[model samples]
Target: MSRLAVSVCLAALVLAAGPAFAQTATPQTPNIGGFPDSPAIPAPTNATYPGVIRYEVDATDLDRHIVSVRQVIPVTGSRITLLYPKYIYGNHADTGPIQLIAGLTVMANGQSVDWRRDAVDPYAFHIDIPAGATELEVSFQWLTQSDNSNWRVVMTQRMLNLQWEKALLYPAGYVSTGITFAPSIRLPEGWQYGVSLETTSFENGLATFAPTDLYTLADSPMFAGLHYRRVEIDPEGDDVYINMVADEAANLAATDEQIGYYENLITQADRLFGSRHFDRYDFLLGLTNQMGGIGLEHHRSSENTHAPTFFTSWAASAGSRALLPHEYVHSWNGKFMRPADELTPNYNVPTENSLLWVYEGQTEYWGDVLSARTGLHTKAQALVLLADRAAFYQNQPGRRWRNLQDVNNHNLLGYRVPGQWTSWMRGTGDYYDEAALIWLDVDTLIREQSGDRRSLDDFARTFFSPEGTDGDWSPRGYTFDDVVAALNTVEPYDWSTFLRTRLDADGPDATAPLDGIERGGYRLTYVEEPNADEKAVSRNWGSDFRWSLGFSLAGPNNRIAAIQWDGPIYRAGIGAGWDLIAVGDRVASAEVLREAVTAAKGGSDPIRLILRNGQRIRTVELAYHDGLRYLRLERIEGTRDRIGDILTARRR
Candidate 1:
């Protein structure tokens, strides 16, 4: 037999030895590669504890209907503890006490031990260990119903709950936390497995990997499936793993071409940053059945989902590529150098760290700039994106309802009161939009002041210097004042007031500073309607509009039980207990109804509705608006100098 085949055969024998030894065996040393001179993995100085010891989870697909997960977390030392968050961060609402972890089973040194749930908070769980316990093992099952939107094992349908399959096992503080994950799936015999972790070992149908440390582990997200292609672009110089997971029926040749595009984008980003931080950084691409896109950032990896055809269309591909850059940049902005308190304490608690504008907004700005800089997007395309964001915020009715500080303080208070209003209210719009503009302003300021010798990159490197002592950067969380202070370091002129007036408050002169862009040989104009060629390439879902009456009606098996008055239905002569069988010759399907509504065209046409009251069938036409509302654009002739000069200014 070949030497490589022999090695694989021996490894298989070791894995087949069973769980008792696997559970007790000491962890193997990490094989650090790539940079020989890189510093050793930093250890926790203040605390003498093992950081994220070991994690094992098994989630079985029960009858192809429901999946249940049983996890065992082993920690170092005689005392073992684990935390189950009452609510995951970014979710903002309590998961409600249903005991997701039911009937705790604890074993210490092959003997069962009694344990109690000590403390419960929105973010963590605390478990105790008895005396003389050398090793600890915790086993609990989480029931996942097939139709349960509240809990999900793989990808969640809700956008806000994207990272639902997350668990944090902290052997220490930020210094260490272990995560355990298992996708609910049934694998075919001899199927190959691909993951993003630095280590890959499979035993008893479970894959395991101990990341570099807590930080790197938290940053690496895992995706498991049979249909995927693993491409390693620069394995020797910079370790980049791309796990492109798609539907089995997808076009493999086209997928390869798209992967090449992504590989180039990531390589360029690394070049811009000047350093590769992680030993193994990965991108987990989950292909969905329909049209939608989302990207979540982990410490060393990112979870990205999009349709396969996204690469076929110029507009769609450009937008998806733009999203990739923003999420990848988070490895620095949102991961390594985070708001210290926000990292440890609850994120919902309000703070004055207006720097999210810098984090989220500056990142948003860079997404476009980097795309254009790398020749992935044209200058005109980038400008259109910026204009779209700006116009969306400018047209909102709630732009004057709140300030940026107030929005930051109440960002987590749910969408209706603080959340949704904060997102949609344009008083300044989300920081992403305003921050992009602010970055442009700062870039202009730096260029003008330093004769184009310094730009926002200087500010970024100075503030987010990985080599600097943590305290030298923002420690107690950065405020508006801190940002202004950082800006003054480069400009050295009292430019703080300029930022506050333009960004924090609405002023007539807020956009005046950008006028110099025209003088610098660029033109700016907002376009609403697409030209003939543009419309030809765009996807249209046809024009058929429908409106919901203000009332909510519910029934079992399509039979009406109660009617909610004050709903659009009640005003439209539809009463409670009226059975709704059709909405214009089509039976209603919850799935298809929403799709039909969003794709409907806007016009003053009445919707045809059929309802059954007792044995009588009543038909009515509901009045609805069906017109397309869009932001228009046009390029100005011979106005490049006027607009370019404004765009090149230091401050508005």
Candidate 2:
């Protein structure tokens, strides 16, 4: 079966059979202004001359998540035009076919002019006006969801006004090449400001920044609200801006520490690249009251979200800081150079780009390594974390079903489902996990292959060198073939098979590129041991409880749904969805009995579940593993000179 089909089926089954689970509930139909249909809009034929641009946005309806915008573009030559991005970045989807542009009135020289929606791509909207018109104004209203606060404009209502996060307004002529932004924000009192851009505050709550190039403009994100702290670093060249916007008051000390961490990360990246790609970079922290965290990279800035501080302790905070290194490195991998396929079609339509294992996976590996090497994390701690990633891939069941390349290419559709499944299995044999291991393996291999002469640093320098052809990776992006060819220049070995097995095939024998490590006279084995910190954290939670309510649910058929953590069935070693036969001492109705489990709690209740494994019905007792569930890492010194040696030798 195709991997996509299998993943969908498995997800459905798990969702139906598993215990109660937590997930981001899809919001009700947002007040997304009005639904805009692309097909209904006519396409543009002729090119119109560009014009001077000025924009004004009034976003008072924070509760509705809507805004009114007025834009004025000056016609220079033949045509005057305006366009709305058909697709919002980071969303990886169309803006819900929603039209924020309601009552889009267009006027030229103070007279209403006939205009039509010319061309529409998920990336942008095109509008045409009379040629050589001195100026034009376009006004519209945009509607969105308040909870949606990653990329694009978002607002939160508190007290009497709406707060803004990730808002940017640009003149229509500029190219969106992920640049630093300079915008003018006008708001009423009781509002604060945060941006990655250089800004000057004026009277009447107006903020302005000098116009920067298109690339620089894309790199800056703006946040306005009452909940933020500005930390200035080194006033030598403009002020290094660190804007932290959280839902609650932040601990100044912690915020300072985070700012320092970012400073160090930027320095290390700059040192490695040997060039400051951007005049200024902004790091905007959007603290949310959510469970998940994400970091999105732009040319000069990154937008990040963090969990609630109360839920995250110092150790957790330190660990979360690892995201800085990861996103900062993107200033190279993703910002300066990116895969063409991803940059072109983007997520509007599915394009086959399988090199995310290199872009994202390798970046992930290096992000952590650099963090440790630069003292952001202890070497031992980093090593343990790497080992944990290895374990996760090795334990995941989905790894048996899909290869890294397949996962990368289909990440938009299958990432979460298979990802969760892989996590559940505690497997570290997948792409991110395996790529990390292989990087360590290859780093070791480079050293051994060159008799301690060369390292991954050498390879990276060559691969990412400014003069290198691969360095021109943007718009269309590079491919595995491109990366392989680059690596081959450093090491003469044929790496085609290595890429195919780990990245392409999902079979059981898909081992990591460990042969090189092994060839470097090193042996590697993964072992699990008790982690004191994890145990301590879990101990405070309470007794580990696992419970299972019997069900023979299929995703489309009678499959599993969700498995609650620390539930009775989970303790009995029952997974989310296995075909259930008998419950306790009788044939229990899956639906009716599940309701009973929810209604009842701990009372030394023993519920026997008979489930079908493959074809045979097997009975297992569910017992929760008390304490916080954490994966532990134990590595034995192999014959190899660390993992890096093995990879080095293989390259040679």
Instruction: Choose the strongest candidate by TM-score.
Output: 2
TM-score to true structure, per model: 0.65, 0.67
Cα lDDT over the full model 1? 0.48
> Residues 214-319, candidate 1, lDDT per residue (tens digit)?
3344444566554556666552455676666654535223445555556666666655554544556677766654313446666467777767655444455554
Per-residue lDDT tens digits of candidate 2, residues 1-652? 3334545565566556534442533323332232333223323322332433464556556667666767665555544334444333433323333344456677787778765443333333444456667766766665645443432345665211211212223324434442222346565456666655566555566666665543344445565655666666533354346666666665323545645655666555544555444556666666655313457666566666666572235565545556767776776676566665555421223334456666666777668766765556654455445544543444443555566666564445533333223333322234455666667666665666667776666666655546544324243356667777876777755667656655665556654444533444433352222355433333321121112232124432333334443344545666644766665666645444353344343534444556776776778654322222334443345554454322121211
Q: Count the backbone clashes (under 3 Å) in each candidate.
A: 53, 89
Q: What is the overall TM-score of model 2 with all chains considered together?
A: 0.67
- Predictions in order: lDDT: 0.48, 0.50
